[model samples]
Every structure is written in structure tokens, then in C-alpha cells.
Target chain A: MELQGIYILWLRDLKRYIRARSRIIGSLGMPIFFLAFFGMGFRRVEIPSLPQNITYIDFLAPGIVSMVVLFTSTFSGISIVWDRQFGFLREIMVAPISRTTISLGRNLGGATTALIQGLIMIALSFLIGFKPSINGLLFAFVFMFLIAVAFTGIGIAISTFMHDIHGFQIVINFFVFPIFLLSGALFPISELPKFVATLALFDPLTYGVDGMRWAMIGYSEFNPLYDLAALLIFCVTIVFVSAALFSKMEVE
Target chain B: MEPIVVKNLTKTFNGFKAVDSINFTVKKGEIFGLLGPNGAGKTTTIKMLVTLLKPSSGEAKVAGYDVVKQPNMVRKNIGIVFQEPTLDLELTAKENLDFHARLYGLNKKRREERIKEVLKLVDLYDKANLQVKKFSGGMQRRLEIARGLLHFPKVLFLDEPTLGLDAQTRRKIWDYIIEMKEREDVTIILTTHYIEEADKLCDRVAIIDKGKIIALDDPENLKKMVGEDVVSLTVNDPERLIDELALEEIRKIVRIEDRLELSVVKGEIMIPRMVEIAQKVGVEVKSVSLRKPTLEDVFIHLTGREIREESGKNAFWRR
Candidate 1:
């Protein structure tokens, strides 16, 4: 857990991202575009009972930022698959380092990249007429980091099960997209039916989005304390599970 | 001291064993060659020794550390160059060596010194700052060897080191390998399909096939086991030739479709007498050649098949 190792891996990740300019933008840019268009398009739809008279754009901003962190972290897990394919994983594995160090370094690298992407989306939100308190902005940063760590683990776990790139894509489209939709990244969980709302309560991304929205727009149907607590529990559990499963993950 | 020792080592994939129960020891400052066909388990055996693949049934100790119980220690004591290119193409040659140096926890001054020395060792010092993507295949392979040596491990494992190189480049690599071995006194274990490569590079060789090692001895002794020389002659008459050469004096005579292979003590003089006898029997001689028995002949004698037949069975890196 040397910070130097983490920093080296972080630099490696950023360098890789910068090298693939179109991919970096495409992965983060498309989501920002949606945040802008939808935030503006839905300006008139306002919830009557919400405190602080939060606008629709302001309400959607936090969710978009959370989605940016989630997407970047999940996609970077595919990079692990590429590493395995290109023999890079073996190169690293053969080194005289603990497997835990290797996994931690990679996950930290992925999470850091996701946080940077989340920041870009947040900056973009300001240009699109969304407003939040300074305290809320700080909270958004912390929430994004936690979401990045949790989703990165889930993403890597998903990658371990896939045998090829095509299978990885199919998994993301089928599993990840549904999780995002069900977690209220596009719509409010309160508007869903009883069974769906109860199920959404269990979605880890739901807790993250709820906590972030509460911090940003200062309005929520669920208690912010509960949301924060659920997110912390979810993040810790996913991290442990991913680390344990990583030992059994084989390239061949 | 022995650099590598195996006690009934084996690795199985599902129901198929990739490395069967095999045991051998490599002494310090020695080059051990694992000679085999494509699917003859050389790579698997090396992987097990390098602590990359776990043995399914037995045990191995590399650099005096048990491969299973102390895998990290074993890995620390040995450097491995894989069959495929593993260097980061985007990184410069110096950067690649620097990364390996850091992985091995070398200090700054020593890391820099070792980088320069290893670059020179492989004769790539002038191209130290050049990116690997721009380097030729030979240069890239040389850089990989340089990186593997950065840690100054006690042993080095090279899996098919010169597999795809041209003959001239392959010879250059072999020269570097010999230089490295002499300079560092490092124990080297390499696997190869080329017979001459093993004969030239290894002090001793293990002939493996079908997940089993058929024989283990020095190259000279292995060749001697098949007799001193083999006289290969292409003859048109087969039945009459077999009847004529099937004398009690000859130890072994093998007949292919268009060739007669005979084991003899002095092939230089015996070849002429055999040709004279063939002419007396009116058997037209197409071509004649005589030489000492090679590692290929040793392999063929052990397995009853050619080395080229097992090339396409294993798809590397496939799940």
C-alpha cells in the first residue's frame, strides 16, 4: 500500500487515457452531452413538495456526475481484460510483488481516473445552469470517489467472468445498463411502484445517487443519513468481495 | 548447489496433463535445455518452475525455494522471458529496464548502472532511449532479455528464446546468452524446438513428448545412445535392399519410403562399402549422406514420430 506504487499506476492510467484522446472524450463526453440536453429539456418539470425549490436540472446534475464516475471505473475494468490478452498481466504478476498490491494498485488507478471524469462532468454541469452549495460540491467529490471505488470493484468482478471482449460488451449492455436504469440515474426512485422502489433501495448505485443528490440539491424523499450509511456499507462489502475473488481470477 | 530441483512435478489441465510426473535437477552455473515438440510440455514445465503455473500433483524448488510454498521468493530469485513479447511497446528501452529495476526494488544508483550494463550486454546501448515499437524484432527481444537481467537473479528462464528470429539474429541472441551465462554465472533453463539450438546452448538436455520426458542426458551422450553415425541413402529398390542390408552385423536398419537409415561405427568408410554393395545388387543409388546422429534422431527414436507432427495441437493463450 505504498503511495508511490499507487502514484506510478495512477500516472500510467492517466498516460494511457491521454494517449487515446478520442476514447477518453467519447467515454466521458457522451455522458456530459446527455446531462446538458436533458438538464435543459426538463427544466420545467419541478417537484412541488421538495424543499429549496430545486429545479429539474439541478436535481439531475448530481446523478449525472455519479454516472460519470460509474462509467469510467467500469470501462477501465475492461482494460484489465486487455492486459490479460496482451500478456501485460503476466509481466506484472511475475514481478516480486504481492498479488494484493497489484490488485490494489490497479483498482486505485481506475477509481482515480473515474473521479477525474466525474469532476469534468460536474464542471460541465455548471455551464448548463445547475447550481449547488460549496458544501454540496465537496460532498459530491467524496461521494464520487466512493462510487468510483465500489463500481470499479463490481466492474472488475464482471470482467473476471468474461472470456472475450464481445462477451464483456454483452455483459455491460445487459447487466450494467439495467443497474443504471433501475438506480434512478435517469428517473427518481420515488416515482416507481412499491416492488420496484423496494428493489431500487437495494441497488448500490441508488444509495450513491441519493446521497449525492441530497448533498447537491438539498432535497430528498429518503433520509440522507440512511443513504450515506448504505453507500458506505456497499462500498466496503464490494471491495472485500472483489479482493477475495481476485485471488481465484486466472487469465487462462 | 543446485539451482533448480523437481520432485515428481506435474500439472494437469482438466483431465489432460500438460506436464506429467517429471523429476530432474539443474546444478548451479549450468544451462539446462528442455527439448520438445510444440505440445511436448516444455513451456508448462518451465511455467511451473517459474511459479507461474501451479503443479497439480507434485513439487518443485527453483533457486532453493519451494515453488508452491515460497512462490514469491522463487519469483524473486528467477527472471523469466516469455515466448510472446511482453515489453510495453510505448515505453523506451531505458524506461522498460527502469520499470523492471523498480519492480525488483533496486536502488537509484545501482538501477542506473545495471540499466547501462544490461543494455550494453545485449548490444542495445545506442538504442536505449528509443521506443520499443520502432525497434526491430531482434532489438525488442534483446531488450526483453536486458530487462529480465536487471535484477541479477540467480536463475533465468527463457521459453523458446529464439523461436521466430532469423538464423543470423538467432545466432546473435545465442552469443548474448552465452556471454550472460559466463559473466553472471547464472543458471539458465531454456526450452526450444530447434535441435541445434539445444545442442549448442545446453550442457544437458531433456527430450520430452506427449506430456512426458522420454530421456535426459548431455547432448553428446544422447546422440551416442543412437550410435556414432547414421548413413542415410535414397535407393529405388526397397525389398531387395532390405534383404541385402538385413545382415546380422548391422545393429539397426530403418527403411522409409525412399530412404534407408543405418546405424554404424565408422560411417565415412562404411558409406562407400554400402554404396558398392548396392551397385552389386543393381540397386540404383539416388543420394547419399553420412553424419553423426542429431537430437532429432534421438527424439524420433524415443517417440516413433517426427517433431513436426505435434505443432498445431495447443493454441497458446486460449482459455
Candidate 2:
């Protein structure tokens, strides 16, 4: 029954995602913009320690992939607010299944869609002269999935407290921007001042960006295993909290 | 045994009573109604029974399962159509039913059969593949009902099932609602502010006002509480007029907007006497119309207030 509930919900989200052609263009557009502008502008600004053949675009490719996951997964979680506004949440709430099953379905659906969006970013990265090995592509897929799961959980948890799109957009503006900026997606955290670098280490997405950076460009400040562990723990905890909060959500 | 047994169910928001201590039971296969004006707690009461909101106090059992303690049990036995449209407008009619059926743990074979059954019951089989957004208002409402009955729930909650539709469309939805009830053999708890809807559809109605059930009985019995007929008199001095026309047959006298509505057993005999008293009292009788007691009249009789909103603000909600 749990699996069936999850499957139905996941399928519904997948259907909606496919139907909205503009959403694909919208989610993909931001990452490509960041990659093109940063990749072109920073090509000559070399960091001290350089590997044999990696360009700044190749270095920024994985961070942008993580950015893709961050955008798609979290926005997918915003469907909760839309569902509440449209009254579809009430239908699901009154059903005989546990809220946990519903949350799992939503997170998985968001993660899968985020993975697809990440895949698109990867394809887009290659087109823009950013290159990674086949092994790196496979690694990027796994790490991006984890990042998507974590960000979607965070978004769903945050949305349970938000009533409308305006509140959600405000939160996305205040919350998602800081997470992305502090995760060292644009610059290496090692170059930042002591306080800012310390703050960046605490961001869960830092691990995500760093882990994907290792896979895509073979450059990471921390051990890849620690980064994976932090993301895994963060994903599980946020997903659990999201489901608990959602179960208590009110409907008028 | 009754499938729904609500006892002293109460809900409050920030110290304001939304649903204050209401009790009633619905017999198996019966069409019961929670009839009240908007913000009079009709929707609040329905939400409580459907386990969408927790009551501030007291208890409710739907399909013999405690709404709070055994919400899943209550949910499994009951299906609800909210006052707002809860359908995934992006999904096809068949897909919507399939989604709901899967949540109820229906196997693929049973899911297929039930989807077909409910779609045909609502007479939307041909349009089953069409997205719900493509449906007209009436078609969307019918599809919602079909989705509600997809799992063959023991009790179905229709919250303003015909609300916001044209009169012709409303009548058509009514046909489908009644048809769904019989075909599914399910007890239905419908909440509506539409007086005639209660008169035509409900086997019993609990008329809620100011968070309380002011009257509860079958439509006929409730109307009988207001006597046989209502003779409404518009006069200059309604209070003085009532004193002079003290007919023993006059069951009740209510003043509503310069008009004195007299509920009487013998409206025919009393109308002339009322006119005579108005002349004697210099009441300046302007007009009088006698009509049979309807559910609306009964509601007004019990609550002493009209069902329609007079002021832009809701008096009940305004502390």
C-alpha cells in the first residue's frame, strides 16, 4: 500500500513536469546563464594549484550541476504550496495512507526530476565546451541525486509553513540564494576570509558542490566520503522533518 | 447502526467557537445534511468529520471509527468532495480515479473495474480520457463525485457538491449525486447552504447556526415545526399589528425587515383576521402573501435569523 501510494504520487508529478514545457526551459536557463557568464569571464583567472587539463568551465560544471539539482528539486517541492492553494492537498490528506508515504513520493519524484534536469545541465555543459570523463558523468548522476533529495526535503519542510506563492518566493529569494552562494558554487571556499569559509563549510550544499566537483573535475577540499556522509544524513533528517510537519498542516 | 455518530463535537479558532458542541447521527445508506449559511460552521463540521481538522473538544465517529484516534480507519471508510475543487486539473478523469484508487490500496484489476464503474455511474465514460481542465464546471463537479466513489467508501462526504454551478447544471449534478448514492449504496453526509438542496436531497438535516445545531430533523418534520403556511405581512407598525391579531392558530411571529412573518396552522383563516387587526390598529397593511412552509422558513423559525448574508461582514465570525 505504501509503495502504491508513493508510485501514484510520483507518477502524477512526473506527468505534470513533462506537460510544462516552459518549466524545463525555465529551470535549465539559470544554470546555463551562470555557466556561460562565469565560465567565459573566469577562463584566464587561474587558481594556484592546477591539474593537467581542467578548465574553469570544467571546474564550474559540477557546481552548476549541483545548482541544477538545487533549483529543480526545491521548486518541485513548491508543488505542495500549489496543491494547497488548488485544494488538491485536501484530497490527498483525507486518503487512507500515511503522510510519510506521501512525502516519500514527493521527494523521490522531485529527486528524479532534478536528476533529469541535472542530466540536461550535463548535456548543456558539454555543448558549452565543458568536458568530464564517462566515470565522472556516472559519479555526477549519483551525487546530484543526493543533492536533489536534500534540497527538495528542505523546500518541502519550508513550504509547510508558507501559505501562498508570494511567501514561498520570498523564502526562495532569502533562503536558496544564501545556500547557493555559501556553498562555494561560484568560487573556491579556500580563498574566502576565515569567517566566510567557516560559514560555507556548514552549508549542506557545500558538501554537495564539493563532492560533485571531485567527481567532475577531480578537485575537492574535503574527503569525498565525508561529503557523501553529510549529504546522506542531511537528506534523511530533512525528509523526516518534512513529513512530520506536513502531517500537521492545516486545511480550511 | 448509524455509520456516523457525532457527539458534542466542537472546534474553535483563537478562542472563537467555529463549531460549538454539535451532535447527530446518520443512519446507514441515508443522505444526511449539515445545512447552514457560509461561515456558520457547516464546512468546519464537515472538515472535522472527514478528519481534516481536529476538534477542540468532544468526539466524532465516521463509519464507526473515531475521527481523531483512528483517522486512517475513518478515512478508509469515507470519501469526501471538498467545497473547493480538489481534482488535479492536469490529470485525465480516468487518471484521477486511478490515483485515488491506488491510495486506497486497490489492486490493478479491481482498480480498472472500479474506475470503469464510477466513470459510467457519473456518465462520463466517453470523456474519461480528457484532462479535467478541459471539462466544464458541471462535468468537473461530476468527475469529482466519481473520484469520491471510486473506492466504494461506506460513507461519502459531499461538501456543497453543487455549489457555484448554474441552476440547470446544479439540477444535473443533483441527478448524478443521487444516482451515485444508490449505485454505490453508500451513506452520504452532504453540507450545503442551499435550502432547496437540503429539501430535495437530505433524508435528515441538522441546521447549524453560530456554531450550534439549532434544529435537527427530516425536511418535512422541520418544516412542520414552522406550521402549515407562512403569511408575510408588510405593515407600518409590525409590533402593534401582532398584538391586535393574536390568533390562537398563529404558531410564531417573526419580524424581518419591516415585514411580520406569521407562521400559522390556518393561514387561510388568519390572513383576513390579520388584515382586520391591521386596520383596527392603524398598522397600514401594505401587502400580504401566504405560502407553504419550506426548509428555509423552518430554519428562520428555529434560528430567528435569515440564512442569507445581510451585511458584508459575517456576524458569527466577528467577535
Candidate 3:
């Protein structure tokens, strides 16, 4: 029963995104472009103490994939706002489904979109000279899924509190952007200011990026096990928080 | 049995009561109307009873379930058409209905069948495959009604369902709604600012204004409360006539539209006296007409204001 609901919602989400070709391009195209630019820009640049076999672009591919997932999942919150403004949200709210089911369905839908975009980015990364083994690809997919779910929960949680489209956009800019920038998606946490680096440790996206990057290139500042564990814990926390908030939200 | 009941139901917003201890009941399969102006509490009361908003202090029940405690159950049995157009503009009318069917947990085959039935009922079967953005405003409203009926809900709540539709389309939907109520034995509670809509469609109506219900009864009985008929005389000076009529033995003088409207047990007898008095005082009588008092008259008599007075006049096509 749960799986069916999840599949239904996931399909609905994908259908909406696919119907709008521009949305698909912006979500999937942006990440691939960033990956290509970075991969080409540092293909031959040698670092002072880096291993001979490691290339900067190859090291950066996994982080870009993780970033793709993050962006897609976070923006998925806008659907919730749109649904409210458009009256679809009320239709769902008045349905007999449990509030938890609603949260789960929406989160899973968003996670699926993020995962699909992440895979597309990974496929493009291969074309741009970043290569990973079969096992590495599998691990990256799993890590991307986890990150997607986590970010989706964060998106849902934010969605419940927004009353208007403008308010929702403001929240995305205030919270999502900060979380994305500080998650070490484009740069290492060690490269940030000490206080910012300290704050990054608590951000859920940090674990997703670090874990996916470690899976791709086997290089990360944090242990892969720790990162995965933190992400799971964060995902659970976000889902529960979102479910509770959604249940408390009135449909007016 | 009462399918729904409200006892002292009140909802306050920002320290102002939107629904002020309003009380009413609806029996099974009955059509109930909540008639009020733009800022009146009709919508708030419906929202509270539908469990969309918690009442400030009072309580209500819907479908034998307490709106506050068994909200989910109440939601399960009731469908709603909000004032605003809520259709997913990007989806075809059929897909929109299909999505609603799935949400209600209908099986795939049953979902498709129900969608088809409702599409036909709303006269939208031919346009089902067309995206909602391509639909006319009337078509979109019909699609919304179709969506609301997909689950065979026991009750349907329509908040201003015909607010912005053309008169012809509005009447067509009213006919469809009445047919649905009869054919399916579904109880329908409708809230509307249109006085004629409430008069023509509702079996019982509660006149609400400024958060309180001023009168509740069958439309005929409520209209009778105003008296046999009303005499409206648009005089050059309304205040002078008000003072002049204040002294006369007129039954009740209600001022509306810069005119003096009086409800008399025998308005035909009182018309000539009023005209003579208007002439004596040099009050230029623009015109005089007498007709049976309508729900609008009842609203003014009870609330001391016209039903649609406070709100901006809605151009026929603007709504």
C-alpha cells in the first residue's frame, strides 16, 4: 500500500517536471555544465601534494552529482506552495489519507526527481573524463538517493510553513541557498572559515556531498560510514518533523 | 437524522470574530444555504465545519463526526469546491479528475469509471482531454465540480461555486447540482453571496453578516418575515422621506439604494399615501414600484443593511 502511494506520487512529480521541458533543462543541465567546466578547467593542473593519479575534475564529479540532487530536492518544495495556491493542496488535504502518508508521498516524489537528476549528472560526468567503477556507480546512486530523501524532507518541512508563493521563494533563498553553499557541494569544508566549517558539520547536505564524493573518488574529509550515518539520522529527523508540522497545518 | 449540526459555532481571526456563535443544522439529503456578503462569516463557518479551521470556542459536527475531534472522518465523507478556481491548469481535465480519484483511494478501474461519470455529468466529456488552461472559466468551474463529486461523498460543500460564472452557466450548474442531490441523496451545504442563488436553490438558508446569523429558515418563510410586499420610492431627498415616513403609520421603512423601501402588510394601500406625502413636502418622487419582498429585503430588515450593500458593486462580467 505504501509503495503504491509512493510510486503514484513519484510518477506525478516526474510527469509535472517532464511536461515542462525548461524545468528539466534547468535542473539537469546546470549540474552537467558545472561538471564539464570544472573537469576541463583543472584536467592538467597539478596540486602541490596530490596523488599522481588524482585529477581535480575527477575528484569534483561526485560533489557535483550531490549538488544536483540537493538543488532538485530543495526546489521541489515549490510544488507544495503551488499546490496550495492552485487548490490541489486542498484536494489532497481533504482526502482520507493519513497526514504521514501525504508527507511520505510528497517527499518520495521529490527524492525521485533528485535521484534522476543526480544520475543524469553522473552519466554526463563520464562523458567529461571522470570515470568510476561499477561498484562506485552503485554506491553513488545509493548515496544520492539518501541525500535526495534527506533534502526532500527538508523541503517538505519548509513547505508547511509557507503561506504564499513569495514567502516560499524567500524561504528557499534564505534557507536552501545557505544550506547548499555551506554543504561543501562546490568546495571542501576545510576551505571555509573555521566557524562556517564548524556550522557545516551539522548541515545534512554536508554528509550527502561528502558521502557521495567518497563513494566516487574514495577521497573525503569525513569517514563514509559517519557521513552515511549522519545522513540517515538527519533524514529521519526531517521526515518526522515534516510529518508533525504537516499534520498541524490547517488547510485554510 | 441531522447529517450536520452546529451549536454556537464561532471562529475568530486576529481578535475579530468571523463566525460569531452561529447555530444551525442540516438533515440528511437536505440542501442548506449560507447566504452572506463578502466579509460575512459564511465561508468561515463552512471552513470550521469542514475542519479547515478550528472554531474559536463553539463546536460543530459533520457526517455524525465531531468536526474538531473526528476531522479526518468528516473530511472523508465531504467534498468541497472553494471560491477560487483550484484546477491544475497544466493538466487535462481528465487527468485532473483522475488525480483526485487516486487521492481518494479508488481502485484504477473504479477511478476511471468515476471520472468518466462525473465528466459526463458536468457536460465536460468532450473537453476531458483538453488542458484546463484551454478551458473557458465556466468549463473550469464545471471541472472543479466534477472533481468534487468523484468519490461519491455524502456531502458536498460549495463556497461561491457560481461566483464568477455567466448567468446561463450558473443556472446550468445549479440544475446539475440539484439533480445530483436528488439522484445520489447527497447533502449539500452551499455558501454564496448571490441572493438569488440561495433563494432558488436552497431548501433552507441562514442569513449571516458580520460573523452572526441574523435569521435562519426556509427561504419562503424568511421572505414572508418581511411582510406581504415592499414599496420602493426613489425620492429626490432620501433623508427627508425617511423623516416623513418615520412619522407615518408605514409598517417598516427600510432604506436601500438611496431610496425609501417600506414593507407594509398592504403595500398597495400605502403607496398612494407615501406619494401624496412625497408631493406635499416637495420631495421629487423619481419613481415608485411595489413587489413582493425578496430575500434582499429580509436581509436589510434583519441586519439593517442591504445584502450586497457594503461590498463594491460587482460588474456583471467582472465576477
Candidate 4:
């Protein structure tokens, strides 16, 4: 019954996502814009610390894919606030399923949507002058999936405490901008000031960006195994935290 | 066991008692009502019973499962239609029902069958393919009702089933509720502020006020507790008229503003006597009317205030 409940919830979200074509297109706008602007605007520029073998797009493509997953996954948590405002959360809360099952289902759905968006960003990156090793593509998918699951968990955890969409938007923006800025997505962390580079170490997306860059372009600051391990721990911790917080949530 | 048993069920919010130790039992297959004005704790009590909110103290059992200790069991056996519409507006009516059916762990074959059956019961089968966002207020409500019964739950909780609907739509919803009771043979507990809704639909009603159950009985019996007939008179100098009309036939007279509501054994016989007494007392008789006691009159007789007045005040506060 719990599995069935989770499946139904996931299926409901998927159906809603598929039906909202404008939302899908709208959400892709920012990532695609970032990709084209940075990939084209800096086509001839040379960063001092960048690897000699790969162009800037190779270094920037994986980071843009990570950004897509990060933004889409975290924003998916807003659906919880939406469901609460519209009264659908009450229906799910009173169901026979456990809160853990409900949270798991929602996170899985969010992760699936984010993963799809990340894949689209990857495909779009190819149209630009981005190049990737064919053999590393599968590992890139693994890192992307991890990024989606972990950040969607974070989004759900944050959403459990939020009641309104406007507040969630403000809070998410506050967190997302700082996380994305410090994530080494645009520039290498090694080129940053000492204190700022240390801050990048705390940003979870930094590891995601490192892991995906290693997979796609065979270039990374951190070891790929270490990145994979850090993401796994983050995923487990966030999933548990979200489930606990959501279990304690009550609707009026 | 009864479908629901509540003992000293209390819920307090920030030290303000929302449901103050209310006790009641709902027999199997009975239509029970928790009738109260807005902010009168009806929804709070339902929330406790449905396992959405924990009770601050006391205990309640629904479908033979403790709400506090065995909430999942209680949830499995009960269906709830919240006061607010809970359907996914983006989904079609049929998809919403299918989602609910799947959550209840209904088999695929049974899911299809019950979805069709329940939607047809609410007369929404033809519109099942349309998105709920396109539905009118009344249609959305009917679809909610259909979804609530999709799982064939042992106990169904409907909070304000006909709230905010037009008179005709309200009547249609009431008809569906009554027919559902007969056809499904499931115990139902609903909350409403509408006196006519309670009087027409419930087998027994518990009238709650200020987080307390003030009266509980069938509509007919509750009215009988007031008197045979109620005579309402708007006369000048109501105090003087009350003093003049001290007859054995007049059981009780309650003063509400400038009007006097007299609970009499035979209102027809007392109306003329009361009017003559007013005439003799130099008090001008403005108007007089006699009718059998209704739930509203009973509420006024017990509380010394009009239920509608409380509702109106609540409406203002809500806005």
C-alpha cells in the first residue's frame, strides 16, 4: 500500500508536469540563456587556470547542466507549498500511507523532472561548440541523477517549513543564488580568493559540478570518487531530514 | 463497535480551547452531523478524528482504530471531503478519482470499476474527461464527493459538504448525500453551519457552540424539546408586553432585541390572547406570526441568541 501510494503521487506529479508545456518551456529559458551567453560571449577568451587541452565550453557545459538540475530540483519543492495552498496536501496527508512514503514519492518525482531538464541542457550544450568523450557520458548521467535527488531532497525539506509560495520563492532565491555562485560553475574555485575558495568547499553543487566535469571532459578539481561519495552522503541526509520534517507537518 | 467513538476529545491551540472535551458516538450506517457556526470547532474536531491533527488530550476511535495510537488504521478505513476543495484542478475528474483509488490500494480492475461507479453516482461520468479547473463550483463539489466515496471507506467525513453553494445546488448535493447513505451503507459524519442542511440530512445532530456540544438529537426531537409552536411578535415596548402576557399556555418567552419569541403549547390559541393583552396594556402590536418549532428556534431557545447572528458575526470576522 505504501509503495502504491508513492507511485500514485509520483504519477500525479509526472502527469501534471507533462501537461504544463509552458512551464517546461519557461523553466528551460534561464539555463539555455546562460549556456548560449557564456559559451558564445567567451568563445575566444582564455582563463589562466583552465586546462590547456579543453575549450571554455567543455569546462562550462557540465556546470550548466548541474545548474539546470540544481535550479529545477530545488524549485520543485515549491509544489509542496502549492499543494498546501490548494488543499491537495490535506488529501495526501490523510491518506493511509506513511509520511516517509509520501516524501520519497515526491522527491523521486522531482528528481525525475530535474533529471529530464538536465538531460535537455546537456543535449542543448552539444549545439554550441561543447565536446565530450563518448565513454564518459554514462557517468555524467550518474552525477546528474545524484545532483537531482540531493537538491530535490533539500527543496522538499525547505518546503515542509513553508506555507506560502511567495515566501518559498524568496527563501529559495536567497539560498539558490549563493549556492550557485559559490559552486564553481562559471570559474574554477582555484582562481578565487583564499576565503571565497573555502566557501566553495561547503557548497554541495561544487562537488556535483566537479563530478560531472570529470565525467564529460575528463577534467576535475576533486577526485570523482570523492565527489560521488559526498553526494551520496548528502542525498541520504537530506532525504531523511525531509521525511522527518514532513512527517511532523500538520495542515489546518 | 460504533463507527466512531469520541471520549473527552479536546484540542487546544495556543492555550485557547478549540475543541473542549467533546464526547459523542456515531452508530454504524448513520448520518451524523456536527453543526456549528464558523470558528465553532467543528472542523477542529473533524481534523482530530481524521488523524490530520493530534488531540491535545482525550481519545477518539474511528472504525474501531484509535486515532492517536493507530492513525494509519483509522486513515485506511475513513474517507474525508475537506471543507475546502482538495482536488487537483489540473487533473481531469476521472484522474483525480484514479489517484485516490490508487492511494487506497485498490486493485487495477476495482479501481476502474469504482471510479466509474462513484462518478456515475454523482452524475459526473459525462464530464469525467474534463479538467477540474473548468468545473463550476457545484461540479467541483460533486466530484469531491465522488472521490471521497471511491475507496468504499467504512466512515466518511465531510466537512461543510454544501458550503458556499447556491440553494438549488445545495439541495442537489443533499440528495446525493442521502442517496449515498442508502446505497453505500457507510457511516457518515459531516459538519455544517446550515440549520436546514442538518435538519434535512442528518439522522442525529450535535449542535456545538464555543467548542462545546450544547445539544444532540434528531431534528424532530430537538425541535420538540423547544415546544409545540413558536410565536414571534415584533411589538412596541416588548418588556411591557412580556409582563402582560403571563399565561399558562405560553411556556417561555425570550426577548431578542425589540422582538419577543414565545414558546407556546398551541400558538394559535395564545396569539389572540397575547395580542389582546398587548392591546389592553397600551403596547402597540406591530406583527404576529405562528409556526411549528424549527431547529433555529430551538437554538435560540437554548442559547438566548440567534444562530444566524453568530454566523453573520463570524462572516464579518472571516472577511
lDDT of 1 at B299: 80
User: How many Å off is the CA of A219 in candidate 3?
Assistant: 3.3
Docking class of 2: high
lDDT of 1 by residue, B178-282 (tens): 999999858999999889899999999999987888999999999987788888889999668878886554556776667877778888978888888899999
lDDT of each prediction vs. the true structure?
0.81, 0.86, 0.82, 0.89
> DockQ scores for all the models shown?
0.48, 0.82, 0.53, 0.81
After superposition, candidate 4 runs with Cα above 4 Å error: B312-319
- Residue-level lDDT of model 1, residues A73-130, one tens digit each, is 9887667777777676777778887656666667888888899888888877888887
**Poorest lDDT segment (10 consecutive residues) of candidate 3 chain B:** B310-319
Per candidate, the number of residue pairs that clash is 0, 0, 1, 0
Q: Highest TM-score among the candidates is held by which one?
A: 4
* Candidate 2 TM-score on chain B: 0.94
Model 3, span A53-123: residue lDDT tens: 87878677887888888888877855687888777787777777777888888888888888888887888
Question: By TM-score, is 1 or 4 better?
Answer: 4
User: Which residue pairs in model 4 clash with each other?
Assistant: none
lDDT of 2 at A152: 85
Pairwise lDDT winner, candidates 1 and 2: 2
Error of 1 at B291 (Å): 3.2
Q: Summarize candidate 2's per-residue lDDT along B1-319 as a digit string, tens digits.
A: 6899999999999999999999999999889998888889988898888888899999998888999999889899988887778999999999999999999999999999989988888889999999999998888888888888888899999988887777898888888878777767899999888888998999999898889999899999999889899999998887787677676788788888788888988788888888887887677989999999988888778777887654223322211
Residue pairs in candidate 2 whose N, alpha carbon or C atoms collide under 3 angstroms: none
TM-score rank order: 4, 2, 3, 1
Classified by CAPRI criteria, candidate 3 counts as medium
Output the lDDT of residue B281, model 1. 98
Global Cα lDDT for candidate 3? 0.82
Interface RMSD, in order shown: 1.9, 0.9, 1.7, 0.8
